[model samples]
Target chain A: MITTRATTRGAAAAVLGSAIALAAGTASAQQPAQSVKLGVVSFLTGPAAGPFGIPARNAAEILIEGLNTGKVPAPYNKVGFGGAKIESKIVDEAGSTAQQVTEYRNLVQRDGVDAIVGYISSGNCLAVTPVAEELKTITVLFDCGTPRIFEEAPRKYVFRATPHATMDSVGAARYIVEKKKNITAYSGINQNYAWGQDSWRDFVLAMKTLAPKATVDKELFPKLFAGEYGAEVSALLTSKSQVIHTSFWNGDLESFIFQSSARGLPQRIPIIMTAGETAVARLGPKMPDGTIIGARGSHGAFFSPDNELNRWFRQAYVDRFGVQPTYPSYHMAQSILGLKAAWEKAAAAKNDARPSVDEVIAAFEGLEFQAPSTTIKMALGKGHQGIGDISYGTYKYNKQKGQPEIVDVVRYPAECVNPPADMTSTAWLEGGMKGAKCK
Target chain B: MTNRSTLIGALAFLVLAAAAPALPPWLISLATIAFAHALVVLGLVIMWRAGLVSFGQALYYAVGAYCVALVSRFTGITDAFVLIVLGGLAAGLLAVLVGFLLARYREIFFAMLSLAMSMILYGVLVKTEALGSTDGFNVAPATFLGYAPEGAMLNLALFWLVLVLSALAAAAIGVYFRSVAGAIAVPVRDNEIRIEFLGLSVNRLIHLKLVIAGILGGVGGALAAMTISHVDPNMAYWTTSGGFVFVTILAGAGSIAAAFVGSFAFEMLRSIAVALLPGAWQLILGSVLLITILFVPDGLGSLFMRKTRGKEGEPA
Candidate 1:
């Protein structure tokens, strides 16, 4: 019975192999016009919905439409991959990481999607990576900013379209050290989660290098979504640090800003926010001027808008959503464009046929392309992660107009902030930032 | 009707196991998650009968899940059965230590204490960098004995295993219900003074109930971790424990069958609510709970019972 089973399995493998070969040959012949199903995962409803998730989901919808209709600007003007249509299935990413895993499996196994995009929570992105690899589905993470996804476990089928948490912290530190040279000491208040913790560590390390004599006056890590910061603000104020760095976003960031600003924390010390761009419009007049902020990279308002891609993307997004595109929108557009570029390249390499997962992944490796926000270089970790520039700017609010805008923007090249392709974030940071290029 | 409950449970088991392969991967996963939660609900059913409601059952759940996760990471043991039992035993051991103190408290004090215990674990997990901090860590795929199933087959195997485990748990607990100690749980609730005067140690009985509930909660958490392939500090959050309590209230804690039925129904309703009204899903669930509490009183389980048989009678 064992021998028979082995022989039957061998025969089945042979049939599967030949079937793949035949399909691969005909797939090109029937190419140039097929539908590539993509599962778009982002938070649709929950506390995270208002700021982080909804914008990304909106961008996914708009970007998918653009790709399908060939409405996007040059270089990404093709109707999906190699002249095929892109049809997407949107899924909510508000629940537990486990729930997202189930959704990922559902997308690949049940719905038969060609790829998966969108995950704002670093936890969700990390949780779905192994499953994505196991399913052999190409997954381009839109936002999730954890470096662990690449350094902890590198896989072929998964790629991060945006910069990790390292860039945000390092860029913020560089801006503080170079631009805000008067500051000799600083304190931080970050959410007590992985993203917050990792950002804090990186910021501290980068600051240690950039300003070795600068002292950390105080540090506080409040629980995630712990809105009240009465005691924390008091501690930060009492510490008398010249700067206060925080990585809070969405409701958490809004609450911290409202609570701390009310108590004159911002007035007392300059605040450095790693993910404060999206909060500017909502915070409006409430957001105090001179608060340093960054959108992880040249995202949101800090992007170079003179380019064709940026102009068209920002216009199309505003026209569709009736609101200005946020940093999440930029990240989502980059992911979709990357996916399209890889699939199209693979298709071209394969003689105009639909490329297999391996072929697409091969095409994606070391692939450099232009995005609406900036030029993305897939030069990290053998092309599994994107390395690009990050911009840090000071918030300037116009109280009369009730608007908040970023000013005095300083851009840090990806090579300077992010670790080299062969090194981990901690390893790179611990090595005193060797071989980093600075402008 | 009481006598026929076993038959009903057996039939349900057969129906589910037989149809599991034909179901979609998502549904199979959904069912697995529902059944895992049902185990916690069953544990709550035991405590409810004794007039005890733990607001921190997530303590045991998280303990179980973390046990499985840690074991798999450290020892590379991926056997689902072994991991589940390890989770149960770990939780049970902790309950034994805590129950000594917990059994003496009642009502809000008991709830608060349990909640505190779970929160303590959540705090520890959130701070532990080796365990991935607040983001937690992914669990390795589980194997069945030496056989490793992948993709759809893996889902099917987990479903069948969960089905078998749930049925066995129900049967075993049903027998325990007929035991003197188990049957006394309700009377202990009705008149603790009278039962204490009747030569029974109230504290001992309560402690027993705690251990039983803890083990069941642990098993549920372990199965969920394996099914979902990820674990985080949220498992020990007060809200996670609140979900278990919600299921128990909806099920009424009358019969073991209510645990499975109510949990499955809850999952179905929640999925529908999430799909139909994304913004108001929580509002919709809250409204449904409000309506059920106001109208049904004793929950959906009471509807299946025949009132003619009076108190302590079997379900229809």
Candidate 2:
């Protein structure tokens, strides 16, 4: 009977030990989720890599890690901010509409992500905007050139890091106007999407407004990335356009450059790629010098000696990612910085360590922050998106590095070009280009 | 397989179909997609019943999508019901026209030719800028008999419509399968000489089957376009057709009920895969597909029936 009692005690002790171990495990998880969920949507794997897609991803990754390590202070040190280590979920849209729709649904409904970043294609962003609105999630669009993003008038939750495609074209037009050449018969070989169509329409409008003498010869809107462009190229050659501008990027851009160069189209006419800072260096000897382009902003290249943020951001980017940061990378970095600034403000006002979306939104009202591109001030005076630097520039190849950098970079200020709360950028541009200036 | 049981089952199926709309919204949306596509699967099975396998039903599917894009985008008609009919009619007419060429071929030839036709549509969508090229066109917010489908009401209405269409399709196919004419179609594969000697028009029968399949494919594409409220060029691409083929194979050529179940299962699995491992969802699905094909050649429908039959019969 005594031995039986001892065995019961022994079993109880074993049970108690196992329970303690389980409790300890539950308590002291080494990888506790102080980790905030970040869902990044980019064209990571497919044809969109070289242009806005990869750069956006590179920026998000570098910025996220930096913010996590307390090296960068934007998202972490925001006004009402508490440090939350961000764990990222990345998706690649292989340039397919169905896949993109599926990806957007997954990002919102399943991931339960705190916020979203990076949407490289304008068509993709337009498709996802409804989902974002429906889900009521905060999204920082690193790059999607559609004017429709703002034209449709976004909720307070959605913010864009880049200028509208129309404004991008306006910047390009400004540069073209400065050249002082009678560019007769400008032809456009643009991809048939919101960005390309919007840019073409806006550029023509701006060019007509500024230089009415220039007539558009041929406007070729090809399917974005179908791999064969011989027919389109041949048609363009026969058409009478002194200047030919394209908005193709990544593999499509690479193919076009190689094809056109081989076909001797480059020697005959001026070829301006509206995508100012794609993986231009990767194109190597093929990309000609001085191709006109636009960016999330021109601040990716810190040419000015006075700006400290530019210097620091560029240095930090080079240190973090081996490559000099592209326009989209800088754009994404700026968005995180914007979020951090607002969060810190909210925190300071509430005297609480963590701030919610409403507090952050309040803080974002009329808050100005310096980024690599230019200074962006979020003005809630009109209850619409009033942030971002409308910076544009031209690409010049650095032969030593064999990479292209934005030269003759023109940074458009908020007062000069950003739309008023009452009117869209299109309406504002329509109202006689009044306050619009070139840096 | 018996006539008495088939009639009873069909009647019971009709009675239960009334309760289909009570499920969750996502489930219904997915099921609606399945039911609509199940009609298409029934077409594939009808072809399979005649002893032919097709890998390129996407050709007619593409025709249906392009019809929607053309009518809605160019004409600016927002009536969902009318637009769906228009899409179906457009696809059917095209199919009947293309059927002349397709009916002449058999087996792999028909499959390859159908694929070639889909590729042609893909080319047109990618090359023509007036049609927005490969970016395609978006369906404007639609009105179903003047009722806007923008919210929960839309889902309910769509569910009901899908249910009605599915039942009608089942009844039609069931009646056809039971008919004397339908019985003769089987001999087209098994005893061509006997069928020929019997003075039946073999090519005409094949052509009729193609037309029926084409109509069903068109209806599925139209329903899909309505559900998403967006359409693009890739809808016509061979991959889109491949997905439908995969669904038909996965569900097997059994009861129409299996189509709804299979589509729901596929959607759930895809969603789960997307959630757990966002990057490898496709790979995971592909692997499962391979496994399913190898283990269950008769498809998911056969499994449940076989198991039930085994339990009722004598034990091993």
Candidate 3:
């Protein structure tokens, strides 16, 4: 026992010695200046992978490759970030927020990525935002729609290249108020998380201002990624709500649609899924007709603008991946495009030299760029959060085409849907959307 | 632990602390997290020695983490030392309360009950919207002796804090291992009746062990929250508890040093694996565990024993 104890101590000492040696040996590898390296994080191997991560990843792969080879159409056709090859280190964001924070550090410190452009989970975005500011890396958040990130605190390095949840909720409420007159009661079945909670809150608040007579009943917040919703479906069915508002995304969105449709819940009450657009292509005829769906913005199937960038992105994306690029794909594409725009603008100001992190951030702020989903305006969150026209439409599964289609698409201008830069979404909604510029 | 082992542990801590400035920010961050988690594994090792595996160590972990985050957020207490103590106390208090009910149970019952307690915390945290629900709030940056650090300096400071706390916890645990109560853990595991016949309450010993483990787990979570600068309900999830148990098994309960070494190895391996193969890192980790279990049944720590036995001309 004495010998064994001695051995343990000796072994432990040896381990510690080796750890120090290893740390000294593995100094930060020199980053190659030939290509613009980016760390792209998304859920690649979880329940979220099927609907959200995979599509977003696919879009990133094709878009980055297109940028590298300069195969993309004009404006974004500049080869990479001002003539440099685009390289990406794709990471799976399937773990805890702590894990994501660690990976974010690894990307910035060890791998020496120029910028990071991913994160579908709102929790992850929130966690990584402060870390990005600390590391002084240009991070473009593609998806994760929690408005609290910018509202809670101001950020210098972190930029969201998509509208927050407020747009989705307000747009959904506006569409409902305009289309469905004299709606007495509505219910909600959102995921019990930041994204879901904020979406429900904003929608309810917007409804209070827009349609004061509408009352909310039977608000159910099921756990996120709770695949089985037998109880939730039963509750929604019995609630007798004129409309059901939900903001469930990824697998949860599809699962709810399938289970609830099976019980004929959607047939009774029109379901307003603010994040429903991602599931439409996958669900097809399974998605109940007349279900009001929003793509979170004028994105994916709801993106109606016929522009050169959209034409090329849609075609290239379809050719690479068999399925049409969903909302996540569009969001990912727009984020990368936004980064590219900032990188190029910064480089141009420096006479085509590689711009520093601060230089790129300067170019990115309050910058308006054309995305595949129309124009993206850095209007809110002090020009760090992107806002654009958000569109909602009724789901119409075309038996003739054997694909899901969105019809009667109503687009709300960015200023109309999003709060002003100075005001929070809550304050704006409560104040009856004062100073809202609607076209 | 003997004087020599304690000296070696202190030497290890010094080496890590001195080397922190030279290491990259990522490595420093990874080491800080590894050391924090090592504290939790240290607690697990203590329980494992007594043949008591509380699968819900994350209960204390989350409690500690939430206590730090909440206290710091509400009371404007930004000091790392105070928040860590508060975290430890909160978790320790809860452990003392739960220890009474837990002392009577053994083996799977104890594991399950602990797991249930942690899940209860997880459920509550998930339902509580003010705490940010599933998307938990961020932790304010910690201050050391009223001197606040930012950027790389902050990372280095946090690393040092974690290292120092870890060293102190390890030294204290080492002393405890030499105590009469700690020395009887194996006997309690082997024959509880004999331990009871020895005029000592086995239940009380187990309860004491539970409290010690709980405090260590809480301290670990508190440090982790400060280092990561965020706290979420997942800290209390079964997976987090399982991770601590996994490290304890991998490190072995034979030596206190094994906990730190094993945890550091686990974190390093995971970071490298994730970097090398982002898609199949879990597969690589599982393979390593399978190989470790099959070849080194006692754990990575037993490999040292084998070396010592070989030198002493014991049965190969």
Q: Native contacts retained per candidate?
A: 0.40, 0.06, 0.54
Model 1 has an lDDT value of: 0.83
Q: What DockQ, on C-alphas, does every prediction get?
A: 0.20, 0.11, 0.46
Model 2, residue A287: distance off in Å is: 2.4
Q: Is candidate 1 or candidate 2 better by DockQ?
A: 1
Report how closely model 3 matches the true complex, as a DockQ value: 0.46
Ranking by DockQ: 3, 1, 2
Cα lDDT tens digits for candidate 3, A97-214: 7788888998888777889999998889888988998988999999988888899999999999899888899999999998899899999999877778888989999999888988
Worst 10 residues of 2 chain B by lDDT: B21-30
Would you list the rank order by lDDT, best first? 3, 1, 2
In order, the TM-score of chain B in each prediction is 0.96, 0.87, 0.97
Estimate, for each residue in A170-272, the C-alpha lDDT of model 1 and write its tens digit. 8999999988687788999999988888889999999998888898888899999898888998898798688999999888899889988888888889899
Residue pairs that clash (backbone atoms under 3 angstroms), model 3: none
Model 2, range A1-439, lDDT digits (tens) per residue?
A: 3353344346335534543453354234333445566788776554566566677777877767766777653334321125656777887755345446555655654445667776876656665665566556677676666555666554666776455566567766766776647777788887765556666777777777777899988888776675567887898788777777777766777778778777877667767666745546466456765566555356444322245556666677778767767677776777777766766677678775567767776676667776655666664223324455555555566779865566666666555555555566677667756655445
The number of clashing residue pairs in each candidate reads: 1, 13, 0
Please say which candidate is ahead in TM-score: 1 or 3. 3
What digit string (tens of lDDT, one per residue) describes model 1 on residues B1-316? Answer: 6678889889989998998877666678877988999999999999999899999999999999999999999999999999999999999999999999999999999999999999999999988877888778889999999999897788789889889989989998999889999999989889999998999999999999999999999999999989888898989999999988888887787889989987876765665455446556677668767755765556667655534345556443
Which regions of candidate 3 fall more than 4 Å away from where they truly are?
Answer: A1-29, B310-316
Instruction: Give the candidate number with the greatest lDDT.
Output: 3
True contacts kept of 2: 0.06
